[model samples]
Target: MKKVLILALLLISTVSFAQTISGKAYYQSKTTVDTDQFGGGEMSEEMKKQIMERMKSFLEKTYILTFSGSESIYKEQEKLEAGSGFGGMGAMMGSFSAGAQYKNLKTNQILEEREFFGKKFLINDTITNLEWEVGKESKQIGQYLAIKATAVKKIDPNDFEMARPRGRRGERGRNRDAEEDSEKVADTTQTESEDPFDQIEIPKQVIVTAWFTPQIPVANGPGEYAGLPGLILELNVERTTILCSKITLNTKETESIEAPNKGEEVTRAEYNKIIKEKMEEMREQFRGRGGRGGGRGRFGGF
Candidate 1:
C-alpha cells in the first residue's frame, strides 16, 4: 500500500508540473544612435520617393516560425514605409512608386524565420534581446505566473551605409591613389608613404531593450533570439514593438511543431563572402559610370 501511495503521489506531481499556461507579452525598447549623424543626409523629393519605394519592396518579404507545447499561433507582418512627403501629391507619388496602397503601412519587419516540429512561424524583430529576472509575481496573464525582464541589443550602423552607398566613391579613389603611389615607388626606387585614412574604421552602434515572460518554460523567443524560459509573445526592438494581442490554449485539435527549411543557411564568414561578391557584381554592373558615383543622376540628387 505504501508503494502504491508513493507511485500515485509521483504521478500527481508529474501532472502538476506538466501544466501549461498561456499569456501575452509586453516590452519597451529604447533606441540609441551610435553614429556621428542621427539621420541620413538630405535627399531630393524624387530620391526620397525612390528610397521609399525600395523600402516598400522590402516590405513584401516574409518568413515563418513555430513553438512547442502550445496551440496558439503567432504571425509577423512585413515592414512598410509610412508618412507623407510635401503634400497629397507627394503622398500619392510615394504610394504609386512603391506599388502599395496606403492601407498597407509597416515601418519595419522581422528578419529571422524559425520552425519547430513541422509547424512554422515568423520571428518578431521587435524583441531585440530577451532576458528574465525575479520580481513581484503576477497572475494577470491567465494561469501563468509572470515576471518582468529586460535586454539590450545594438543595431548595425552599416545598414545606413549600404542604403546610401556614396562613400564607396571615396574608397575607390583612395585605391587608385595607392596604386599610383606603388607605381611611382617602383619606378623611382623610393619608399611609398602610407595613406592616412587607410587604417580608419567607422564606428556604429544602436541599443534596444525588451521584456519577457518565463512561465512557458521554453528558451525560444523571437527572431534570431532565444535563451528565455518561455516563448516570447511580445517584443520592442528599435522603433517597433509587437504585443501578443490575443492567445488561445488547447482545444479539440492538435498542431505539430517543425523546423523551417530556410534555404542556404550559412555562417557569418559565408554571408560576408556573399555580400562581398554581390557588391563586386554591382560595381561591375555600373563600372564605366565611375564605380561608385559613375552615374550621379542615378542617385537622384542626394
Candidate 2:
C-alpha cells in the first residue's frame, strides 16, 4: 500500500506541474540599417541623418512572448507613439511590420496576424522545423546559463528587410519610337520600370545564431523561432538581434494562450502574393508623386 500511494502521489504531482507551467518573456528587438545604402540621387548627409532619426523607432522595438508548455503568443508591446516626426515614412515602414504571432509546438502549427496597408490577414501555416546544431559554447544570459545553437533559416527572396536601395532606377522606354508597334515591348517596358524589387538581390537564406537555456525547459522563443531544447534567450538573424530582457515563470497570473482568430484567413503563399502586389502598387504611387524617391524607398529609403 505504501508503494502504491507513492506512485499515485508522483503521478498527481506531475499533472499539477504540467497544468501550472506558463511563462512570460520580454525581449528587446533591434535591427540595424545602413543609411549609406539609402542615398537617393542628390540626397545630402544631413538628409540621411534625418532619415535615420525617423527610422529609429521602427528599427528598435519591444516584444512580449507569453508561453505555456505547448503554445505561445508573441506580439509587440503597445506604445503611445512610434516616435516624433514619424510621418508618411513611418506608415510605409509600418506596412512591413508583423502583428501577433501564435505558435503551437504540439500541433506543429504557426499562425500570424499581419496587416498590410490597412488590410488584415491571418496567415495559417504549418511550422517548418529548423534543424538546429547545438554547440559546446555556453554563455550567461541574465541568470540563466544558455547554450549556443545555429541554424540556416530560409527567407523569402523578396524579403523587404534585406532589400537595399538601387543606385539608380532601371532603364525603361525600350522600343519607345515604335510605341504600340508590339505588345511585347510595352509589357517589357512596364516590367522594367515598375518592379523595383528586381534591382536588389535579396538573400535566400541567412545564418541564425540562437542561445537557449535548459533552465526554462520550454521549446519556445520570440517570433517564429522554436524547435530548441529550451526557451531561446538570445537570437541573432542577419541584421536583427533579439534578446530576452526578463522572464517570469510559473507566476500566479497566467495569461491565456489563445491563438489569434481575427482577420481574413489566408495561406502563407497567398499572403506573400498579396503583399508583393500591394508593394508594387505602393511603389508606383510613390514614384508618381516623388519620382526618384520611389527608387530610394525600395529598401531603407522613404
Candidate 3:
C-alpha cells in the first residue's frame, strides 16, 4: 500500500509538471482547387484567376494554437479583406472555417465555436482518435527535427462545411456571424434515409502526412489533427497543407487555456444533425422557386 501510494503521487506530480510546459505555434494553411469543376470546363485565364482569387478566402488561412500537455486553444487569425471589384458576387464563395477549437486530451473532448446564419454555437464533443502510422523518415522544420507520420482518415460527406451563402455581397465563410448566446440546445435525432447529407458524395479515404517533433511532447496541431507523439509542425490533409511558420516556447507569461462555454453544448452527432436540419430548412424555403416543384430559387445558394 505504501509503495502504490508513492507511485501514484509521483505520476500525479509528473502530469502537473508536464502541463506547465506551454508554447504557441503559428500555422499557415493553404489549399488548392481545380477551377474547371467550378467554372464548367472551358474558361478564360482571367476567369480562372478571378475564381481562384475569390476562393482564397476558403483555401488559404492562418491560425495560432496555444498548447501545453493535453490542452490546446486553436483560433484563426484576423484576415485582411481582398476581392474582385465586382459588385457583390464575391460573397458567394465557399468558406473553410473550423472556428476556435479548444481541445483537452485529458478528457478527450473538443469545444469548437461555430457560426451559422448569424448565430454562434459551441460544439462540445469527444475527440476523434485518428490512427496514425509513424514513419522512419525525418526532416527539419524551423530548426526542430520532425519525424514523418501518416494517417488515413475516412471523411464523411455530410461533414462538409460550405461558405456562408450571402446574397449578392459581403464576406464569405465565418465572416458573417454573431457572438455567442448563453442558451444551449442539443439535437436528438438518429441518422435516417431521409438525411440531407446522404446526397453528398464523399471520398472513401484521405491521406494525412504530418511531421511532428518529440521535443515539444504535445500531441497537438492545427484543425482536427493530433494523435502523434509530439507537436505537429507540418500537416498535409487532402489538398490543404498546414505548416508551422513560427513557434515560441515557454514564454514569460503563462496563458489561460480552457474550454469555450459560450454557445450551445452539443455532441458532434448532434451538431451534424443541426446543420442538416438547417440546410433542409433553407431548401424548403426555396422549394417554390423553379426547382422541381417550383423555381430555381437563387440557383447557387450554397
Candidate 4:
C-alpha cells in the first residue's frame, strides 16, 4: 500500500512540473498565390510581379506562441511601420485577420479575439480535436527532433486568408448595405454583375502536415492548432507554411496566460456568419466600383 501511494505522489509531482513549464516560440508564416490566375490570363508578367511584390507585405508574416503545458496564446508579432499610401487598407486588413488566440488544453477551450472593420468580437469555442496520423518519418528542426503527423481538416469557406485567385470574375454580384449589428447581417438575394473578388476560391477541405517534438511535452501550437503529444514546430496547411524559427524555454520572466476579455462575445458559428455577410457587402462595393470604371479588376484594385 505504501509503494502504491509513493507512485501516485511521484505522478502528481511530474504533472505539476509539466504545468509549470513555459516558453515562447517564434514562427515565420508564408503563403504563395499563382500570379498566372490573377486576372483571367490578361495581366502581363511584369504586372503580376508588381502585384506579388505589393502583396508580399501581407502574405509573409511572423507570429509568436507563448505557451505552458496546458495553456497558450498565439499572436502575430508587431513590426515598425513605414509610411505607405495604403495605410487605411492595411489597418482594415489587420483587423480582418485573426487576432490573439488563447487555448486551454485542460478545459478543451479556445478564445479568439477578432475585429471586423471597427467592431471587435470575442469568439468563445471548444478546441477541435484533430485526429492526427503519426508517421515513422523523423527530422531535425532547429535543435529539436520532430516527427511527422498528418490530418484532414474541413476548410472554412469564409476564410479570406485561404482565398486563391481563379480564372475570371463571376457573372453575378450581391449588393447589400453593410450592417453594424451582427443580428442584422443575413444571407440575402443578390443582383447580377461582374464581381472581381468572386475570382477567388476557397477549397472545401485541406490536408495538414505538422512536425512536433516530444522534448517540449506540450500539446499546443501556433494559431488554432493543438491536440498533439508535443509542441508543433512546423505546420503546412493549404498554401501557407508556418515554421518555428526560435524557441526560448522556461524563461526567468513568465507571461500571464489568460484569455482575452475585450470584444462582444460570440460563438464560432456566429462569427463565421458575420464575416460572410460583411465580405458579401465588400464584394458588391468593389463590383459597383468596377462597373463605374474606378475599380482595378485584379485583386479588387490592387
Candidate 5:
C-alpha cells in the first residue's frame, strides 16, 4: 500500500511539471463598407453582386500566428461586402503599380508573440509566461481541460485598412475637397449613441473570449495573445471558435522557439507614407482608365 501511494504521488508531480500545449484555431469575420460614400444612391443589383464577390475574395486569404508557447496558422475566406461597387473600386484601383494580386490580401494574421507587463515569451524557448489559472471552470476539449476567460480587444480601423493598398491620388485641390466632403457625410450618418460601444461602428470593435486549460500550465495562446493564467486551449472571436485540435507533450523536443522577424522594417509614420504614395499611384491609374464605365474595374480580369 505504501509503495502504491508513493507511485501515485510521483505521477502527480510529473504531471504538474510537464509543459506544452497545441490546438487548432477557427475564426470568422465579415467586411462591410459605408453605402453613403461615393455616389449616394440606392445600390443596384449589379453593384451588390460585385461587392459580394470582392468580399468573398478578401476573406479566403490565410494568416499566420506565432508565440513563445505555440503557433496558430489558418485562413479566412471572404464572407460579405455590402454597399456600392464605386467605393470598392475606388479603394482598390491603385494596385496596378505594385503588381498587387488580390490573392495576397490577408484579412487575418498568424498568431505571433504575446508581451505582457514587459516580459516576452517565445515558442521553443522552454521558459514561457504561461501559467494555469486556479479555481476556474473547465470544459472537456477532447482529452484536455479547457478553462474560460474573456478579454476586451480594441483595434484601430486604420491598421486594418492599411493592410491593403489604396488606389491613385486625386489632383491636389480635388483631393482636399473630397476629404472635406467625406467628413461632412460621416457627420450626417452618425447614429445617436445609447452606449459607449454603440458610438463606434460594429466592424471597428471586437471582443475576444478565450478558453484555456492548465493541462499545459503555460499562459500562452495563438497570435500576439497571452497573459491569461493558463495555456489557451480554445478561443472564440466574432462567430468563430478555435479549439485544441491536437497536442504533443513529453515528446522528443526539437528546434528552439524564437520571435519572428517579418513585415516591412519601417516606422509607423514611414509605413503610412508608403501607403499614401501607393494609393496616389493607384488613383492615377484609375483616372487613366477613362472613367468606371469601361470593361469592369482594374481587378476584373483577375
Candidate 6:
C-alpha cells in the first residue's frame, strides 16, 4: 500500500507539470545594416542616410513571445505607421518572409506561416536538436539571474536576403518547380547565375551565446531556440541580439496553442529549395544589368 501511494503521487506530479503555463516574454532586438556595402551608386549621400535610418528602424523592433513549458507563439508588436518607404520597400508589393512561428517542444514540431511575395507558405518541420555547452558564468538580465550557454550552429547561406541579389520592384514568388530545374545538371562552363546558391562555396556558421534563468524551469525560448533549463531571456545569434525586457507569467492558460495549418505545405528543405531557385533568378537579373564583378547595388535587403 505504501508503494502504491508513492507511485500515484509521482504520476500526479508529472501530470501537473505537463499542464501549460501562461506566460509572455517581451524582447527587443537590434541588427546592424551596412549601407556602404550597397552604396557607390548614383544616389546622393543624403538619400543614402535616409534609407539607412529607415532600414535600421525596421530591423530594431519589439516582439512578444507568449508561451508555456510546451508551446509558444512568437510575433512582433504593432507600431506606428510610416510614410512611403524608400522605394516602396516592405510594401505589399515587396518580396520577403516574416511570419509568426509556433513550436511544440515535446513533439519536436514547428509550423511557421510565412508570407513571401503575396503568397503564404507554411514551413512544417522537426526542430534540429542543438547541443549547447552550458557555462558556469552567471549574469542578471533584469530581475532574474541568467546562466550563460554557448553553441555553434550551421546556417544556410541562401537563407540571408543580404547574401542574395534582390530583383526589381513588385517582383514576387516564382511558381516554377525546383525539381524541374534540379533534374538538369548545372552547366560547368557557364556561371551559375540562375542558380546562385550553387555559387556559395561554404555554408555559413555562427556562434550562438544564450542566457537563460533557472527561476522558470521551462524549455521555452524565442525564435528557433529552446531546450534550455529555463526561459531564454537573452539570445545573441552572430551580430544580432534579442533581449527580453519583461515577462508576465499567469496560470490563466485559456488560449489554445496549435500549429498553423494554412498556406502551401512544404518541409523546411523543400522550401529552401524554392528560395534557392528564386534567388538564382534574381541573381540572373543582376547579371543582365552587368556581370557580377562589375558595379555596386542601388539598394539591398537585410
Candidate 6 ranges with C-alpha deviation above 4 Å: 1-20, 35-48, 79-94, 161-203, 252-254, 289-302
Each model's lDDT comes to 0.35, 0.70, 0.63, 0.69, 0.40, 0.64
Q: How good is model 2 by TM-score?
A: 0.73
lDDT order, best first, reads 2, 4, 6, 3, 5, 1
Residue pairs of candidate 6 with colliding backbone atoms: none
Question: lDDT by residue for model 3 over 125-243, one digit each (tens)?
Answer: 87777767676799988899999988787655456453221121212323222311110110111011122222233454677899998777676778777766678899987567899
Candidate 5 per-residue lDDT, tens place, 1-302, comes to 66446434543443344333333333333334443232233557677556556545443333322222233333332322222243433334322121111110012222223221122322222222222223256689877777676655544443323232111121234575665666555444432211111122324445576787655654445444555545566666653455555554533442243334333344334443454464445445545654333222442321
lDDT of model 1 at position 227: 40
TM-score per model over all chains: 0.42, 0.73, 0.72, 0.76, 0.43, 0.70
lDDT score for candidate 3 against the true structure: 0.63
Which rank order by TM-score, best down to worst?
4, 2, 3, 6, 5, 1
Where is model 2 more than 4 Å wrong at Cα? Answer: 1-20, 40-46, 79-91, 158-201, 251-255, 284-302
Top TM-score: which candidate number?
Answer: 4
Task: List clash counts for every candidate, in order.
Answer: 19, 0, 10, 0, 31, 0
* Model 5 residue 177 lDDT score: 65
TM-score of 3: 0.72
Q: Mind giving the per-residue lDDT tens digits that candidate 2 earns over 1-302?
A: 66446434543444345345798999999887555444222458888788777777777889999987577999999643343454344545555657899998778899999866556889999886886777789999999999998989887755564554333122234454453354344345434454444335456677899999877767778998987767899999867899999998884656678899989999887887776666677766756655334433343322
Candidate 6 TM-score, true structure as reference: 0.70
Against the true structure, candidate 1 has what lDDT?
Answer: 0.35
Residue ranges of candidate 3 with Cα displaced over 4 Å: 1-17, 80-97, 162-200, 251-253, 284-287, 291-302
Tell me each candidate's RMSD, in Å, in order.
14.6, 10.7, 12.5, 10.2, 13.6, 11.3
lDDT of 4 by residue, 1-302 (tens): 66446434543554455586789999999887756444444679988787666667667889999987678899889643311223223333444646799998788899998866668889999997776777789999999999898999886887665555443222222231222122122111111333434345667777889998878777778899986667899999867899999999983555688779899999988888787776676666756555333222222311
How does residue 213 of candidate 6 score in lDDT?
A: 84
Q: Judged by lDDT relative to the true structure, which candidate is superior, 4 or 6?
A: 4
Error of 1 at 32 (Å): 14
